[model samples]
Target: MSVNIPDKGRIFAKKSSFYPSSCVTEILLALLGIFVFIQLFYYLFVFSKLMRHDPPTAAYAGAPEGVSVLVCAWNELENLRELLPLLNAQEYPLFEIVVLDDRSQDGTEDFLKEHADQWRHVRFIRIDKEFPHITAKKYALTVGMKHARYPLALMTDADCRPIGTDWIASMVGQLGPDKEIVLGFSPYYKEKGLLNWFIRCETFYTAIQYLSLARAGWPYMGVGRNLMYRTRLFFEHKGFYQHKHILGGDDDLFMNQAATRTNTSINLDPESFVYSIPKTTWSDWLRQKRRHLSVGNYYQRGNKLRLGLLSGSHTGTWFVGIATLLWGLFSHDTLLLQILGAVFALRWLVQLIVLGGINSRLDRTVNWLSFIGMDIAFFIYYVGMSGLILSRKKKVLWR
Candidate 1:
């Protein structure tokens, strides 16, 4: 199917028969002008609206619901050993930690058996190899959910640890009365490197977009680390049936299909945050991102278009805006150059305001000087990013 966007006059100009070349030039310039304006409007209107959202602060009434922390692990012997003790030590009144050891060979089953067999609240399940051809991660997640004993099921990766002892409590607090899903922030622990900076900045931006949109009654997705939704909602939605064949959607695609504005809630309590271990190498980070990008093809059409517009206009802001400015300078068009310069400054100012606050909120440092440089470099960055999306051969393993 072809897309037919509604065209308005002056902005969407048509070429003339007699002066076709000149009309074409005018049309291109007008389109560039419209594109830059859209970029400015997006930062000012669409994304910057995130600044208005506040953290979930209502007192959680009554006794908080018991949570079944469902973790799916494959060869996460080290992580499980370190985090399980902390999970059990939560100060919350009622909760259980359930882990699925999916055919792990690195002594994961042995580690699981020692504690799960002895403790009442801690549980573990072993899944042996099967030939029926199923997405291993989704299957493991489903098994954990089926065996969950509490009303709410909280999911976190084996490599993740709660930000604080009250992590479970803070996440549970957001599900108050009618909220079925609680979307929480998950930030990677800061390390010393440029890659770490990029990872942190990306995480902060993603959180701002998802959290802000959720607050605006357009909830879309949540992170698996520190994510909670009712067990009933899981079974009701048939536990990843929507995109079960794909391995990575256990967190996002499920949210894309199941979340609705009224039923979903967000918890921005720093206490509710989950800290994930960032991949130390470029290859590792690429594989992790490929897993995420693979699921984009399956998002709902409207949501996909929303992202396309957001990225496209962002791209246009750099390439088209620069080209327009260069053309004005070459032609000695002072008025055109002046207008473009003002818009460029305005856009940069707004980005600094919005992104600076977001960085602070997520405990990340904001480099005021690097803001423009990074924004410009992202044009080249996205080209490689698009390639990662297309290279679906790299798998997202739970291990």
Candidate 2:
């Protein structure tokens, strides 16, 4: 007597019931499929809507508000030399430039002192020392915030250069009675090398996510490179008093606590954007990424969970999808093979549409030939960041 043999899929399905790990993998894939599909919807619909929104240069009509551009320099005399002149040239009628020379052993203080007389609107404060226990940036920024004469504080880095003369006006133009925080896009300058290209794409992708989330009415974080907030809000929230111990998060943590759907606005106008110099070496880039990732643990619980789900799903989609495809190939499971291939193709096509438009709007360059490799690289980046954030032995010192 012989038993009847089922088809390949039916045979695999029958065995999957008996194999506990296989059954668990199937269940996990099913749930992850649902999650990743939802995430794709967010990317396609919600973030695409943001891409379609008018650029702030054209849409925003608010009168020029009093704005202060805050830049903190730490051993960045060369950068400040190039950066200060650009700030002095901004066409905005009412604004001031305040620089916090955060204990720089370099000639930042002397450079500022030499040029301080020429730019009447520019002010510099020398911070040679701070409370040894506290992070220097928080202390330095607090001092600069106090020195700002304008009600609106626009913050950027010494290494960042404004693209256009209207950068200040474009940023502060979004401020009204209701909107107190302005999230501006900052992109890394495009360079010939692969590292710079990846950095540019990463920066643009990050900006798109944060700006889209803000547009979705779930504002979470902002990049300090081109972020603006009300001066009063800083004082109301006690000015980073809670997270002063952390080296980073001055911009993002403040936004996480203070920014609201009604109060926050995003501006991706080309003129509003700034160019940040990307790290040239692999080690430096990783160090910069580590510092940024370090503050993520301090984010609001809801935002943290939401962002975690997004990243987790991205990693799972690649990892488990590849594994399933491999298994299906060997097991002769044609349906599973087709399903995984179709999902990846569909998601990539949608991403091209959504991210393509965003890249165009933000003036970022992406190498389509290496998109998959970059995606995998980003997964590695996220993993490394996780290890760095979790390790107590490893510390991210403030720059």
Candidate 3:
């Protein structure tokens, strides 16, 4: 059978464009200019708003009675050596600590059993090797949740360290009778090189974007490093029921489906923060980030909107920079381009000035000169990997 094609003017004509090349270029440049302005304004507004209010003061200094702490690990024995002592050292009077071992080959089971007697609330679980899926971390946490005896449940990875003895109390204190989820801040441990600094900066900036959104009405996600929720909420949401098959993002993805504005709370206390060593090498960091981004497609609409706005800002910034350079090359109006460049400088200067205080508090190194290059590298990597993440249809194992 022969298929009839539509008329040229009716179909192909609409796809063809004969606008003057100069006009088309100008239109594109104008669109780029608008995008850059919007990008600058959005972050500027968020930064200014976050600065306008003081970080919330914790209402309590310790986890309430009957709080269960769950730490999940795979081949993370040495991390537990320091981690358990830290937990035992918590100022809180009442809390139970449990560690889930996901078929670890690093003798994590023996290590936990060896130190199991040191703490009053310590417990351990060793998973059998015959488990069905590669999502061991979530499965292990599920096991811990099954054994949890407290009304409140808090989760932190074995590799992470709490900032202070009051960490548990501070995190759980944010919860109230009505609150079901509490999102806490976590930053990278201070490190030695440019790579470490860049990692912390990228992580911190990404976190600020999401956590600030949580502070606003749209609460969609949280980091697992220092996440707490009610035990009832966990069962009510079915505890990663829908996302269990995905190898990563058991934390934020679960929060994406579970948290709401009325039931969620944000804990910004510095003393309550948890710090994990940032991946120091490019390859290690890349693999870790790839695992995290693999679950991005599973986020809800609000999550997508927030991330979409961020991606647009990055694209617009590059478009503006390139367009400005080209305008200087081909246009006769050199003075107008110079004026625009000055305004752009002012905008970035304001940003750096605000970031100065934030960087100081987080205790991450700040090298404005180096960040210019780091930011370019991060933007390119994130944009390139975003396509791979968005198109993924199968469950990917955690790297």
Candidate 4:
């Protein structure tokens, strides 16, 4: 009826005089640090294998059978002029280019009209009404989608430039008989300094996660810069119906509702890539990220859980690494410090390797150390802004 408790003397005896309460705390912190490093290592291993066995590029001749391309523009007339010519030069046959002018006060409508005669496939939709939601892109896309004459619809932004003449062909070619959606890679054009390098690095990292998950049969999202889906699938799934009340999540949320393992894919072929201009300013980038993070609330529970773990891993590593370093400095625990350094080095090595692979994959040049600093900044900003946005009901406006 009564359970025996361990003798206090025995318990006390097991505790080493050298292992003070502070030492115990330090030891626990060190173990936590090790755990984070190990988990990250595991992710790297899995991610590496996914990269190794990525699906080969699909080869479909001519234009995508029954497909239409949509580009949405606000005040990007000059960019659109460059982008339109590139679109016109695509090798794809039997496709049309439709641009939705989101009530641009700039000469965007005039530019489209001038070019409409020059390019037969070119068409324009002028959205005169005020954008209904913070997700202005989605509203414009919806209007464009209605005008599409084909069953398959592809969406890209005005700032994106196709990598090759076969860009459209490669993307459309990936649509298997049963597949309803295909996510394509959107890399960035090179830039001059650390910010640009960091942007590319961050973009590459995002690509790795999305591409790996797509390979793993859990395709959750795609960038609007180079994304394709069946026109019917959009309407069938109610077309961002539930998440429309929110300001973000046109891509991921729609993909969340519409994509299944059998119906989704990633087109990683070099020819299928599209390059977009990176945000030039840190404030601009932060706003973009804030809009993106606002939609995290709408992800499927499984995805939410995965993302939570990923965030925790980064947060855990930073806290544990700093705490352990302080412990080593204050307590002079050389062994503990060595363990922490070893873990940090290993994590950095894995990240560097993974990042190198990403860089090579995207043809980017990154200052690895500078990228680490940027990553930390991003982590802090994302956590803080995301927490604020998710808790508040204010609609996110694109700056």
Candidate 5:
């Protein structure tokens, strides 16, 4: 007697009975489902805030207030030379550029001294020594803020250049009567390299998180490169006093503590954007990222939980999704394969639409066609940097 056996196609046709039989495979499938759900939740709920946001093109309606642009520089003479003229030419009615020279052995001091008469709005404060009590960068910022001539303080890095003459006006205009903090976007100058693409993508994603959360009334962090706040707010918070011992977090950690939903506003105007020079080499970028990520441990418990969930789900979605898809392929389970394909397709679709909108708003550095590949690269980045992110030992350098 000969027994009859069903072919692969016939087995696949009976989808109901073709489910994974192995416990491990079933568990992975379940986890993939959960992660996909989380990803969708973030995309449809949290990130949608940014996607739906319509930036205003009109100038601010309220009366313009005097703004003191605060820049902290450490051996950045060359960058300052480029930045000062831009600051001096700001179209705002009343503003001053206060540069904090933090013990720069470079010709920054002489350059500022020589150019004092040339740049009408530029002023320099020299920091001869460091204070053991506070971190170097924070201490420098504190000194600069103390010496600011105006109540409104707009902070940008020495390496940053504003998009246009309206940078100060656009940023200060967002600070309505009630708001104390205004978060602005800063993108890296586009360069012809894979590293530059990743940097821009990473920056856009970071902005999406904090900016969207701010829009959603859970404001957490802001970048120093183009952040604005009242001088009173800084002094009230004691000026990075809580995390003074740590090297980084002049912007994020301070915002983490001081920024309330009602007090913080975001500036999305392209004219307000500040462009910063990116690290050209891999080692330089890695060190910069390490210093930045080291401050994540100091965020509030709720902020940490929210960010951890978003990032954790993002990482899981890629890893678990791939594993399940591979399992389905090896097992020749047509239903499982279809389910995985649908999950991935849904994620990519949502990412394309939402991130595509965001990319258009900022610099269009991320190629929508290659977004999934870039996302997978970020997943690898998260895994690779996990150790540094979770480290408790404080980074000691401020440069």
Candidate 6:
């Protein structure tokens, strides 16, 4: 029982060794809390809009309105061959498919000329030359819209095929008198590769944001693979004249500039979906994404802020969350570790529920169990794409 009085310095050191520095722990805890709050806000408040959405039944009171299906093709001869039959077979009346061939050297002209009589609803316009100032895709789209026969214009890529024959009717049914822009869903065909999974998940997440935000009266963008609007809206906005010099954004940039809460509508009908062929290689996919994201800088200030917060918080949720957990473990603080675990668990639980519902609603290919992995992937993707998105120097070509 030699209570040999230990030095005061030794006692202080022993206590300090039991836990990490208070300042570091407090700062990390505060950051973790904030990031968790932001993550929950998006899942609960923002994404939940899509989760809870109930698409109206496809209906029309009168003769099915005429719709001009715009397909812009450059080197999409095979795709057009596969897609034309489907477009001609759509279970809708008075819909025309206008294919604008943008100086294709790949026999697209020959193929269309050969089968022009077979595809009754399909029509093709060969663009012999390119506009020096305009991007290829935008120029083709502008020409297609100008030649659109119907008042309503439905756009899809040449590489995309509708899931069902009712695609036009389902999408057109959403356009009420007040709605001018109709945003439709487009998913990549299920292929056997990790790249395919990533592409599908990325598309799913993007659809969630744009479709959900559109429903929330903050419509920002739409995918060209499956999108629709009144031809009047395009001409009124000068048909991509604002950003014609920049590649990509033929769909999104136009939507960002034209879509409004009252005029925009979203069609989630599975039949309305158009499935496109995804990029098989990483380089091809990266180039495609670079073009897609190049227009982000031109988004409306409010839209940019909204998307930035959502993406920034998503990135912080992983980075700050992991850091906090590591610190808690290092400090040997059971309470801190337990709190961090609970926060992460809660966030993931919400994510699973919300995103799971979305997957089931849109593309059921991605397993809910893979959400944690995809969340981490998205974190990496956002961080990686931030620079490319910010840089206005990289020239993106739309082929």
The model with the greatest TM-score is 6
Best by lDDT: 6
lDDT by candidate, in order shown: 0.78, 0.82, 0.74, 0.77, 0.87, 0.88
Worst-scoring 10-residue span by lDDT in model 1: 9-18
Per-residue lDDT tens digits for candidate 5, residues 129-229, read: 98888888898899988899899999999899998999998887777667899999998888888899889889889999999999888988999999999
- Provide the lDDT at 338 for model 5: 89
Models sorted by lDDT, best on top: 6, 5, 2, 1, 4, 3
Model 5, runs deviating above 4 Å: 1-22, 55-63, 390-396
Kindly report which residue pairs in candidate 2 clash with one another: none
Model 2 spans with C-alpha error above 4 angstroms: 1-29, 55-64, 367-370
- All candidates' TM-scores? 0.87, 0.90, 0.86, 0.87, 0.92, 0.93
Clash statistics: count for each candidate: 0, 0, 2, 1, 0, 0
Which 10 consecutive residues of model 6 have the lowest summed lDDT?
388-397
- Expressed as tens digits, the lDDT of each residue in 1-399 for candidate 6 is 678888999989988865557777888888888878887888899888786788788888768778999988889888888899999999887899999988899999999999968988988899998788998888888898889889999999888989989999999889887999899999888888889989988988899999999999999999999999999999999989999998889889999999999999998788898998999999888888887876788999999998988898888878887887787788777888888889888988999999998888886857787899888899999999887666665555686
Residue-level error in angstroms, candidate 6, position 194? 1.6
Runs of candidate 3 exceeding 4 Å displacement = 1-25, 61-63, 360-375, 387-399
List, residue by residue over 368-391, the lDDT tens digit for candidate 2: 555566667777777777787677
State the lDDT at 287 in candidate 3: 65
Point out the higher-scoring one by lDDT: 2 or 6. 6
Q: Which stretches of candidate 1 lie over 4 Å from their true place?
A: 1-29, 116-120, 131-133, 332-335, 365-370, 391-399
lDDT of 3 by residue, 86-203 (tens): 9878877678898888788998988877879978878888887545653777788888898998878888888899988998888777877678888877888777887787777777
Rate residue 199 of model 6 by lDDT: 97
